[model samples]
Target chain A: MATFSFAVMAVLPLFLMIFIGYFLRVFHVFKESFFNEVTRFCFKVAMPCLIFKNIYSSNLDVGSYVPLVVFGITGIISLAVIGCLFIPLTVKDQKKKGVMVQNLFRANFFFFGIPMITNIFGEEHIGPAVMMVAFVVPIFNILGAVVLAFFQEHEGKKRVDFKDILHNIFTNPIIIGAIIAFLFVLLKIPLFDFVVDVIGDIADVTTTIALISLGGTFKFQSAKHNMPYIIRGVLDKLFLVPAIMLTIAVILGFRGPELAICLALFGAPGAVASFVMAKEAGADGELAGQLIVFTTAFAFVSLVFFIFILRSLGFI
Target chain B: MASSFSFAFGAVLPIFMLVGLGYILRRLGYFPEAFVTLINKFCFEVALPALVFYNIYTSNTTIGQNSGLLIFGALAICGIAAVSLLILPKLVKESPRRAVLAQNMFRSNFILFGIPMAANMYGNDGVGPASILLAISAILYNILGTAIMAYYQEKQRSGKKSVHIVPLLKSIFKNHIIIGAALALVLLSLQIQLPNFLDRTVSDVAKVATPMGLMAVGAHFNFARAKADFRYLMIGLSGKLLIAPAIVMIIAIFCGFRGPLLGALLGMTASPGSITSYVVATSMDADGDLAGELVVFGTALSAFTMFGFIFLLRSLGFL
Candidate 1:
């Protein structure tokens, strides 16, 4: 019962936001030109400040999770290997192959993941979550990029360039912010607490605004075309994968919060990485778009079940 | 502190309002065909880079030891994602478009929405790690991501095989966000202090970034296009909300990840598609509409998925 209410609490606002945005558009409260200016304003000035503020104020730690890092990486490698075995057999077209690689393995570690978890668990759980992100992002970049490149390249055509992958990873804005933030933390440099406080305040406001924008962007029309892919994606990401992961967690003797975090993440929607990979690999960009929509929509069901399952096992 | 419900609702309000306005204007036929292009250019070239530069430059967090481990971990996660990308297409026997849809389903939105949440949750420490991950992804988005787009375009054009390095590098360097971030890093490394006036000026300019961005995002929201692109949108929704997160869990567990790292990693693993994908698609002339659909659908669906993940984690004591 508590879980059900919680689910409603979580879902209601999202729906409202989308509905409101859509309705406003339908009603013509403002001009289209205004949105462009707003997008420009956020993207150029505000977002960068937010990124700078976060990194400049934080302290970095290098050896925080050596064992965890190693284990996490190894696991990804194994999955990739297993996944690769199925790819060639399942997808004969090189173009299609590129798309497949992105779908199954990519993880959504940013937008929804960070905000949702932080809101639920507070700062204490942040350290572990942060550490995990550090480990997971690069593998997605290089390996994901390689797969994308490989599939994107015409059959019997030019060889894939390793340098391109490195370049892509190095130049990214988000990645750059991550690097600077890491450095600040590592050096143990002191920043003005007041500056951080200001940034924090701004961050709070920005987060809400970003969410609103996100809501406004939702479109239901596309769901119709993406049914089959949606079903498959949902099964793989929400059910099959999480079930396997929970079993592993239970077997490993991880109890309490540790177990909970692992299980919840396991059942999360597909990563946004697939979207990026699809675009990069020259797959069906529209199809990739729809897949993200479908899986996320169904995540609530999987999550609720997981919570019940965990509660039943006394993992909480 | 704001509760999750309040926080999310509050965050999303402005964008929706703006989108509503944009929609009305379109219906009224007040704008020319080039309006979208103009809006997109402003958001893409100017606003985005500035936002990125400010974010990277102003960070005061310290870099810790074992940074390499974080990098490695990200790589490993990517490795897993690569495999998923490879395999999912086969399981479903999807077309190239469907295959890409499957992959996008799994990726995260690290930029606009992801990083700020990291800051809010863990303060500097969390943001620092997220930044590293984002950087790695940036690199991938440009060279590797671009290469793939080129490959597909070539295939469609007649199975051509040549990869262009110059254009890829040019795009990366020419990107305002990347340039701004680079500048910030250089300034920070040199420990350059801004003059009081300049600092104030910078802050003032930065202040407008978010609200303006939200407004722009709202204004750009296209319901009609989404309706037209429904098929692609479905694929994106499923892949992002379902398959991606599941894959992350399997990979994280298999790799033996636990604790907060597991949660944070998974949280990120569940993000919707990024706005940048749209930008990249536009720049490459690949499929910006698909990118936009992914961003919109993924963002929307993520709420449910994210909530479920959070609730499950809390129930199991992770939260």
Candidate 2:
């Protein structure tokens, strides 16, 4: 009961904010221009600040958790590879394939993962969770950039621009944020308390505002056509991936907060960046949006079930 | 005496330097034109909202006690707006330029300058009153600025002399800054606490509003245009930095406002034209160059005017 309640407590605010966004859009409280401008702001500035702050604040004790780090990275890479191969078989649309493949691996770790972990395990135990973010965020960006660029649609056939891919990866604000944050941590450079506080404030709203923006731009018309893809994507992300990844982690003797963190990595909804990347790369942005909405909407159930099972097994 | 002068300098110089840094960065091609727009948009939609919300939410003072400040702020803004609307168009002769001039005259750079200046004078305790004033003033500025700009824009566009209230109201209501202020006020009044994580995140994001806004303002400065609009620019500068503030300060003082309250009011009246004025002017198809010029001149000259006001107020034992 406690775990269930915790799950609800964790996820309700996110959904509520998204709903407020949708409501505001319906009521014309915010215009399309407002959402577009805000989405760009989030993509460029807020998300980067969030990524940088998250990694910078985390204590990266890489040596102590080699196996967990190894398993986490291996899990993400394997999923990306499998997703790239498998998505083309199911999704006929060239643009959607990349978005599907990308989102299948890139969970909303920063937005959904970090908050849920903090809620369940307490903030003091968030070091491992933060460390997971340190590794996973860069991998997500690089993989996302490469995949989107590779599957970018063109009217006439043109080869993929490898230079564009590299540029995209390097110039990605979130990736840059992570790299800068990692350096800050490595160099032991102290950020002023106010600076961190300020970053935290910006980072704090990334999830809510991003969700709101997502809700504001959401198209129910597209959802009717994309229901199959949306359902499949949500199930794969929330259930299949976590089921496979957590089983492996458990078999490898992972348990408790570590297992929970790993579960979050595998189980959280698609990263909001997936939608942004899709839209920017001319991929199937609608599908990406649907996947984020559906996955985020139902992520609570998966989270509750996972937390309950882990707690019942006395692992968390 | 020297200490007070230095204190006044300490309060004002960092802000000036930041604006200068923004100008230099833009000149050196460090911050691209698009980057300036992005920074301003972020300031408008996210940072400024967060700043307002956080300040209002965390303030210890009740709204009841600060009703006086709120009333004084609303009246001051309405007074300025009324005066500007009644007189500026006749002087300027061109509708769009008049709209820009009137807006520049009435709308002070309160978010960037007012809050910080107040904080500099009286610390966090001062922020409550300053923030309340900011919220009221920002709403007024948007409503009045939007109406005036839209009216002139419609006149120019359709070659008709009628103001359309519906579209004007829509634009005013849709403003994110005003929405943010209204939300903050509601939450503050209800005594609702944002969760700790959310609170910290908001305050953190809010911290960027002032610096980013100042920087964006500096980046938007056009030196050539400033030269072109030299006469109009001087009118705007004198009105924004000198005349308008002097009037408001005298009124605030007569109303028994002293210390940080007077300082906050002075900051509101004396600061530069708001960046939003330029944004609205451009969006409304008004004279954006002139709007930008007014902002640049108002901001550039404000460092001296603000110093003068602060020093004078302090000398008079009002701050």
Query: All candidates' lDDT scores?
Result: 0.55, 0.74
C-alpha lDDT (0 to 100) for residue A11 of candidate 2: 58
User: lDDT tens digits, residues A1-316, model 1?
Assistant: 7655544433333334334434544556424444444334333333434555554553334364454455456655655665667766755666656555566566554434444444344434545545455456678777676666666656654456778777876775455656666666767667655445444544444433343344344446656655655566568767877787667767766665455456545555655457756775667666666666666667657766775667666674
* Candidate chain B TM-scores, in order: 0.73, 0.79
- Lowest summed lDDT across 10 adjacent residues in model 1 chain A is found at A9-18
- The alpha-carbon lDDT assigned to residue B150 of candidate 2 equals 68
What CAPRI class is candidate 2? Answer: incorrect
Models 1 onward score TM values of 0.46, 0.70
Please give, as one word, the docking class of candidate 1.
incorrect
Q: DockQ for the candidate 1 complex?
A: 0.01
Model 1 chain B poorest ten-residue lDDT run? B6-15
- In model 2, which residue pairs have backbone atoms overlapping below 3 Å? A197-B204, A198-B204, A200-B201, A201-B201, A201-B202, A201-B205, A202-B205
The top-ranked prediction according to lDDT is 2
